[model samples]
Target: MAHHRVADGKNSLRRRGVSRGLVFMLLAVLLVASGVVVWFQVGDHVGREGDAAAATCVEGPATVAIIADPDIAEGLSAIAKSYAETRPVIRDHCITIAVRPGDAKITLDGLTGNWDPQANGQYPAAWIPQSSVWAADLVTAKPSVVDGTPESLVTSPVVLATSPELGAQLTGKLDWAQLPTLARRDDSLTEFGLRGWGSLRMAMPTGAQSDASALAAQAVAMRITRTTGVLTAADASSKGVAAGIGALTEAAPRSPDGTPVGAATAIADAADAADAKAAPIHAVPITEQRLFQLTKADTTAKLAEVLPSGPTPLADYPFLKLTGDQVPEYAATAVADFFRFAEEPDHLAVLTALGFRGAAPMPPKTATVTFPVTPNPMASPETAAVVDINRLVFGPTS
Candidate 1:
């Protein structure tokens, strides 16, 4: 009996010891797994933070951000690409530039009031708007942020264009003043073999609202107030002036309900349309550069140009430098370097090839079309403000 009791006590002691061993083994395995998990988690966090730090630690001259009008974006982009390859070094630091195309109004809006770099995408170290008119309007409305006078990179005059077939039927160079009277005459449409929609459809840009259209409006206002050389409040209020301007609006070629079509594309489409019944866009007010592009693109659709008389509004592509904190320390010098590079005769030649009138005298063929070398004529900011109001009351609803 004593031996049986002793054996039972020994078995119970061994069983308890084995159970404790298994518990310790399980705890050890769990502790090791937890340590590995903690190590990986810590490592991943550090890695991500390190990547973030590296991303923002770019050294050397800051990359220049150039925002430009879409009309000249392609040409500017090409110029930028060429500049990047050359890698012009400024102040012993290599400089780089990035170009983006945006709407002129949107870019102008972005440039206004305590310009925020991040909100404006990147600080516009340089801005090349379609015309100096926009820059002038901006400067007149708000104090300019431009470091100095905006450099005119290229120039183009506003011109009238029509398809070859339609142009052939029109009488001698049409005067800008005659446009309103002609718009009211239906007989002129019949003279061109155009009837109904195909008749003498005239297209003008949306005045005040669109830069191009506003320019056209300024041209009209110039004709209205040429003796004074500036549009005045009285001129805007004049019944005859208002009537003429209204006639321009009434004559614009649009959809059935008068929705404005894209000025260039509409003209091109009219020229290319297969159906003879499709009303051809008889005449459109556009820039000579644009006319050149359309004619160059389609051999079948030969667009002829009629230069506007008087002090015509020219598209002087201005290079504006952003001032204040919006611009980096190195940007101005780099911009100066770029300007120097661009002004070189060779670079000017390249710009001319892209359908711009460069700084240097162009070839004879390009010179045939006259544009003022030093045009001072532009609608005043106050005049533009009034025009905006008038357009709302007198222009198309669309």
Candidate 2:
């Protein structure tokens, strides 16, 4: 009886030891699983923290103000939006750009003299006028205003825009020299078999709003003087040039409401009108970029572009960073960063898409372009000369 009781006690002790071993093993497994979970959670948090630190803007959200020419403002605005989306960091500052349209003359006045921030919006960090002529004027008026050599972001030739039918009819028959006579003629379109069109009507750009009219006037002065080199101020004010420009101004079209039509697209839009005599604008001087955009908007756009046989002025959109004692270093850095992005092949595509001749711009498929790529030697295109010619063409600046 004693041996049996001893055997039972030994078996109970062994069972207890076995149970303890099983518990230790289970606890070990649980500890390892918890450790793995903690490690993964900590790693994820660190990774997220690293990313946040990189993206976090530490210094600033700097706004670079750009005073763009009205014509180029829309394109620049688009690029600026893209730039913001990328969260560009310039000089340790998160950067963005703002584009505002400022008339070349008015903006120059404000720039050279005093900038009424209330009237002119923000004090500009950069300025893009329709032509380098404005930059030259800036240099002449205030040599210290411009920081560096102004470079052209895009180039657009001023072309004659008309309906496809009328442009085709006038082909080989028209020249810039003959334009004044055509404007003054009694029956302008009859010779071309365009009978319904009475006298030649046009939307001559003369206001200081855009550089198109000024360029056209410069072309007129160039032809009248018969000079191919850079036009002098005296050459632009020749009597013959004034008379020639005067004739075209007299031919300005009147809308059905008897309001004077000065829009370059008036002639092109007239072609799509249901009425034959709706907007009887025979022709107008316009930038190729404007024409390209106008046609791109409408699938069934009906227009033709004609390049003059003679030299035509170019709208070289100049990018100028303003300089003065008050200009900030960070602003200049921001402008340069934006300009660098703009010069990239991808960004240049944006300008090309907008219709300016930038980064290998192609011809528009919508309009029939006679001379899409080439140009003759320009004349009298200097700012002062252009200003003189503008005076003759558009009259004195208001």
Candidate 3:
């Protein structure tokens, strides 16, 4: 019996030793796995840290993105480049201003929605829309997103651009009411020895899609309604005004393809054709500033401005900074710097040369123009929407 007990005890001892060996092996595997994981995590953290450091090294001191109307892009770009070259450091950051020129409506729309990177490039820190109405509209829609009060950078009232000869011929008294008579295809000018002026072909910036066109439409609407404060949806949809708008739109110049050309292109075409003693468009609704720019650029197409009786829409170029996290602190400061730089006396002179009228007194040699003391705000967003809808619904089919 004793010998049997001794054999059993030896077997128990062997089992115990095997269990201990297995426990040590399991602990060793777990330790090795934990060490590997820690090493990998440490290496990944170091890599991320290195990448951040590199990014910091390559980043500019400060960068500001500005989006301006395409019409004023060249001048704005020149100004931005010059400012960047001579600007002092602001908030310990040497600033860089990247100016991108885009369609006023399209750019505003992008701001209202998710910005399209492919179409609009990088997000803009600031916007220099063609008119304050755009900013007003934006504020109306998203007031919380508006950072600060939009400041008018410069002013340019809408004008009727005409060829030099045609302008000379129409030197008599004409008001906004005569636009339909003058623009119609009939031979209404026969009494004036002009015979047939080939139906006053005209061009506008963009029907309702742009402020230039909307303002012109509003001017025409005012002529129809004969009330100038604000054209409500009812005013826009009125049968008489709607019909007048249709006539005006129908008179807009179209390409050979029957599509309406943009304002800038239309002006360029008129300028090009004028050298051949032929004007493609008899008149166009354009900003006075734009007329100045055109005259300077193309000598053959020196356009004269025709101011109407009623209050006209003024392109109060507004300098506005975007709100939200997308626009960083540094960017806002940089944008403010550019705005201040632009308003400086020297910079204002540059703007004057580019045909923009500053808020300050008109400098020597600049055109002397008077604007209405109390001009209406560019159509409010709601009014603008109504105007656009009316345009699409009543646009001239002819």
Name the candidate that leads on TM-score.
2
Which residue pairs of candidate 2 clash? 231-380
- Candidate 2 — which residues are off by over 4 angstroms? 1-59, 82-92, 103-106, 133-143, 188-196, 254-265, 268-279, 297-301, 361-364, 367-371, 377-380
Task: Please give, for residues 1-398, the per-residue lDDT of candidate 3 as tens digits.
Answer: 45644556655655435577899999999999999999999999999997665545444477678888766667778788889787546555667898888776677677777888888887888888777656756775666667888886777777776655566566455566567666674765443456546556666445432555556766777667776556676766778776776777767664333212244344445644333235556666667676565455453544556676666667777888887878888788778888888888776666666667775554333232223233443443244544453354334222
RMSD of each: 20.5, 10.9, 17.0
Candidate with top lDDT is 2
Pairs of residues clashing in candidate 1: none
Residue by residue across 213-271, what tens digits does model 2's lDDT show?
66776777777788778888778777887788888887766433321224545655564
Candidates 1 and 2 compared by TM-score, better number:
2
Please identify which of the two predictions, 2 or 3, would achieve the higher TM-score against the true structure. 2
In TM-score terms, candidate 2 sits at 0.74
TM-score of each: 0.67, 0.74, 0.67
Question: Which one wins by lDDT: 2 or 3?
Answer: 2
* Count of backbone collisions within predicted model 2: 1
